[model samples]
Every structure is written in structure tokens, then in C-alpha cells.
Target: MMSNSTGLLLHNAKDDDDEQSPFEEVAANISNKDDPTILCLTFRSVFIGILLTCFDSVVFQFFAYRTSPLDINIGLIILLAYMMGEFMSKVLPEKIFNITINPGAFSIKEHALITIMATSGTTTTFAIKAITVQRIYYNYPVTHVNGILFILVMHLLAFSIAGILKRYLVWPASMIWPKTLMSCCLMRILNIENQTETTETRWTMSRSKFFWLVVLFQFLWYWFPGYIFPLLSMFSFICMIAPHNIVFSQITGANGLGLGVLQFD
Candidate 1:
């Protein structure tokens, strides 16, 4: 029942579309693949990475318990980091007393590394429940020293195990780090340094405009689920039928072992 001519035409169009896979972007940007400058493991990178990680961790921890959990987007982080790095590069003296301390330029490599460090710390602290259970439920003795040590040990143990196995499953260059790749693309699109061209009106949306548009949309839309009509997030015909059936609703309700069948109403 298929037409061979149409299929052949589609195949030919695909071949002519400049078949460049986005995942291979990390490999494509190298003029000399052996050059190590792209790694961006400088002193400035470490300093910025640490600062951003602290900020990112705070943002994530603050939102962890909110009814409408909000994630600080990586693109936003990259934008902020770029602005801060640029400000320092331009305003800060590159050398003090003829001793060079600052690079005076923020490389894409440095930006990427900073983003990666921040991301690692932003994940939800899974060991929080253990501390809570010990303190609140069991009424066991809990001190700041042991609590901090317990968290560090748990976090480091997972890191150590994964790191040891990373050479096999994670450290390979062939593995496309999806999150890193996305961050890279965002950086490339938002690169604002060393520009000399005048702005032009475009048919397609620019990244800056698109970013603000998304922010505006999400800000306006979330109110419906968070306040105005909270039931939009989780609704079921079963709930409407038997409003008083506590047992049935418990099993098929939002945040209550339900399948999470969402409905508009």
C-alpha cells in the first residue's frame, strides 16, 4: 500500500538536510583534537565552580519540599555565570603587582566546568530522611557533628563506588553526556562575547527572546496548578464518582499511591 517514489523522495531529502547529529557537537568543535586548552581546568575555573555550586545547592534545597517543586534551569545558570565571568574579566585587573592571577577571559570550557560542578550539588539529598527518622521518630541523640559526618560519608560512598565503575560505564568519551551536551548547546547559542555585528530583525526567534518567553509562560501557567485550580494537577473520574470513598481515593489519588491520571478539571 506504500508508494515507492514518495519513500525515495523522503530518503533523498533526509540525505540533503546536512545530517549533523547534535550529540557529536563536543567532537566537532576541535580544530586540533589533541589540544588540551579546551579542558578549562584553571584556578579561575575552580574558584567560580565552588561559588556556583554553593548557590545552586541553596536553590535546590530551598525548593525540595515545595508543593510545586521548581528546578533552577541550567540555561539560566549558564547565563548568570557568563554575566558574572564577563564582569570580572573586564572590570578586574588581570595582574596585580605584575603577577598574573586572572585569565582576563572566560573560556567556554571554564563555563562548562562551572555548570557541571553546580549541577552535581543540586541533586536532592536522599539521606535527609535517615536523619529525620533518627531525630524525630526514634528520638535518638543527634548532634551536628555526627549528622554532618553521616551525610558526608553517605554521599562520598556513593561517589566513590560510581567513580570506580565510571571508567567502564561513564568515563568513556563515547558516552554522550546528555545534560552536558544541552548545557554546551545553550552556551553556544548564548555566546555574547567578542560580537561586532549589529542586531537584525529575524523571522525565527532568538535564544534570548525565547528564553524570556518561556520564563513568562511558565510563571503565568504554574499559578493554575499551584493555587487557582490545584485539582488540575491530579484528577480522576473515580474521585468524582465516590467523593466520600476514602479508601478507594487513597489508592487512586495524587500523592496517594495512585497511578497519577491527570485530568484538566
Candidate 2:
């Protein structure tokens, strides 16, 4: 009985040790995958900043000429700023900004500055394109000076309104910018992967086929209208006659902005 009891005790101790070993390994693996917190905050700030810029572009769409200032947009400029901020922060001397300032890192203020600069470039481009479109396409009679004034005023308006409102709209506690949050998470994962030895192989289909398919559809839509539609219209006209049909007149007048003809004849 004593020998059996000793054997059972040894077997239970071995199982306990085996169980504890895996938990420790998992904990270490998690620690290895840790990402810098700054990555999340920076990414979110940039994303929201761009979102505001895009909103400005959208507002321009409702105005004459479908113009944005500088032909610059939120998507392109904000992305450029984020990339440049990261690069510049890495390249500039650590003490350039301040004696205590660190290289390759920034406070919220610095990040906002980068975002604003990038947005300025985008807005400027939008304004230029808008003015060109108005001059060339819409035949806007406004002189060069007035156009410049309009562009400047519109830009200032958008920037001031967006800047003032961004804080209240973007940074509420428990508020979720879902797209921005996803972006933040993706950036964090990417950063963590940078420290790992593992290489991830991505699987994707060639987009050429999809691109061609879309091209083919668009070609058909336009081609059918340009060629077949005119032919069909010609055939309909050939089969038609001007009988002064009351029903036809009624239908035609129904499509117009006034009531159908009322005749006592």
C-alpha cells in the first residue's frame, strides 16, 4: 500500500509540472508580441485629422465647380504627412526641437502639426483644380484676383471649423472611430511583427482579371449607348407618325413641369 501511494504521488506531481510549463510559455509568447503604445495614439490622431480634411473636400463638392482647394485631398495628403512625419522624426537630430526631445518620436502637438501641413498641401491642390475647372469647363467669369480670394477664404473657413470641431467630435471617452481603430490595431500588429523573426506570406489573386472585367463592363455600357442606342432611336422614329395623339401628348406633358392640355374639342 505504501509503495502504491508513493507511485501515485509522483505521477500527480509530473502532471502538475507539465500543466504549469505551457502557461508560462504562453505568457512569454504574449510578452514577446507586445507593441509600443505610441503607435496606436499616433495612428489614431493622424487618421482623424485626415477624416476632417476629407469632410472639408466633401463640403466643396456641394459648392460650384465641385472644387477642392489645391486639388489636395484628405486621403493623399494625410497619408503623405504620416509617412513624412515618421521619416522626418527619424532623420532629424534628437535635440533639434528641444534639448530633451527624442528622435523618431513626437508628442500630440507635433503630430497635429504634421497633419495640418499635409492637409494644407491637399487643400491647396484642390483649390487650384477647382479654379481651373471653373475657368475652363464652367466658364466662370470671375477674374483671377477674385478666384484667388475665394479659394483662400474657403480654405480658411474649412480649416477653422474643422479644427475647432475635431476635438469634440473625435476624442470622446468610449467613442469609437471604427475605421481608425482598425487602422491602429493593424499598425500595432505590423510594429510587433517588425520585432519578430517570422515572415508572413500573403496569398492574393491577380487583380488584372478583375480590372479587365470592370473595363469590359464599362466599355459595353458606353458602347451600347453610343452605337446601339442611336440605331434603336432611329428605328423608333421611322415607325412613328405625328397623329397628334391625345394619349401621347398627355404622356409627354406628364413628364414636363405642367399639367396636360385641357381642350373642349
Candidate 3:
């Protein structure tokens, strides 16, 4: 997950700022015959692309159910949504339909927002699964506690594995995750820096707005579980306690939160 965000930030294909030396000759030749109309058109098209992504993400979240067509994986849906967006841009008429698709509309802020939404759903699903597994199995008593422990251990193992593989997968900069490529292309379209400067340090206005929005939200969101509503963070503990009662146990199983049957059984 951290690597995903890192890729969004360091997509050098989209941002020339990663290069130390500006391609001055290339820029000079291009600027000599620069077309403002083309630039505007490209920007418009890219904006459409970002909008399409946002729309697809939202639609998938709304209609995607826990089973059947709705049961599709979020990551798969995101990829499909991006493809659909790309397709629409190419096939859909711009003026006749009064809609345009452009990859330039995607910014760092938009990417982060989309990612957070996508990840939040995935996390919730995993958490629910962990709860289910605990209640169904471990009939030896203290099943709830054991289940919580199981979840923690599994997450720790996942993180550990990710850490072990990070050096090989992420450090060399050659692991071209395809989704990363799509994101980079969109980000590049969004950036407005003239191609002359290889390393422009100034933040684009859109990027600045997005950066602060994320910062503010991150600071504020953590406060709820971290301080104000601390119990929200201890949901698993609450779940364990509630399961000690018969009513809660019935409710748990009914709500699909109990792990009454383990596969091993």
C-alpha cells in the first residue's frame, strides 16, 4: 500500500522534474511551434479521464455487492474502470455529446483520494472476514480472543513479507507495475510545467490544493479514533466482549461476523 502511494509520487514518466537535466533542445524546437489550442484540447481530454476514473470508482462502490456481479474484487474493478474510461475517451464524441475525456485531469490529490476510497473498502472486507473466521471456529472456548490474535498475526506476517520483498521489487525502479504506468500517464497530463526545465521545484496550484487537503484530512481523521472516540479503534475488543453474551453470539453469526465453522473442521 505504501509502495502504491510512493509510485504515484515518483512517476517519472509523467513528471520531467525527476530528470536532472532539461531537454533544452527538444523544448526549444517544440516551443517554436507550440499550439495553445492543442494544449487546451489535451488538458480538456485529460480532465475527462480523471472524471471518468472518479465516476467509475464511485459507481463500482455503489453497485458492487458482496456476491454475484457486486462481488467483484475492488482492485479488478478499478482496473476495469480505468480501461472503460480510456475507451470512452477514444470512442465517445466530444462536442456532439458535450463531454471530453482527458488524462490531464488526474492529479496527485485525485489519485490519493481514489486510492484511499479503494483501500478503505478492501480493509473493511478483510476485517469482516477476520471476524467471521474467529466466531465460526476455535470452539475450544476463548474463540473470540484467538480470532483477534489470528488477525493481528496475519497482518504482521503480511507486512513482514512486504518488507522483505521491498528491496528487490521497489528499490531498483524497474518494476513497472502496469497500474503505476496508467497513473503516471495521467499525472503527466495533469502537470503544467513547460518541458524546458528538467527539475521544476515549484508545485502546481492543483497539486498544492490536493497536498493540503490530504494533510488536513489525515490529521483530522486520526484524531477521532486516536483521541475523541478511542473505542472506535478497539472494535475487535468490543466484539470479543459482546460475544460472551448469547444474544450477541446469535447476532454475530446472523450478521456474518462469527466464525462458527473453520475450514479445518
Give the Cα lDDT of each candidate: 0.70, 0.48, 0.48
lDDT of 2 at 138: 93
Q: What TM-score would each prediction reach against the true structure?
A: 0.59, 0.33, 0.30
For candidate 2, write residues 65-147 as lDDT tens digits.
43433344443444454555566556656574455334356433444444553444333346667778887899986788988
Q: lDDT by residue for model 3 over 196-262, one digit each (tens)?
A: 3336645444543564476578778888878787655534443465666877665444345644422
Count of clashes in candidate 2: 16
lDDT by residue for model 1 (76-142), tens: 7787877876676677677888765577577777787878887776777777767877878899867
Off by over 4 Å in 3: 1-65, 69-120, 123-144, 187-265
Candidate 3 lDDT: 0.48
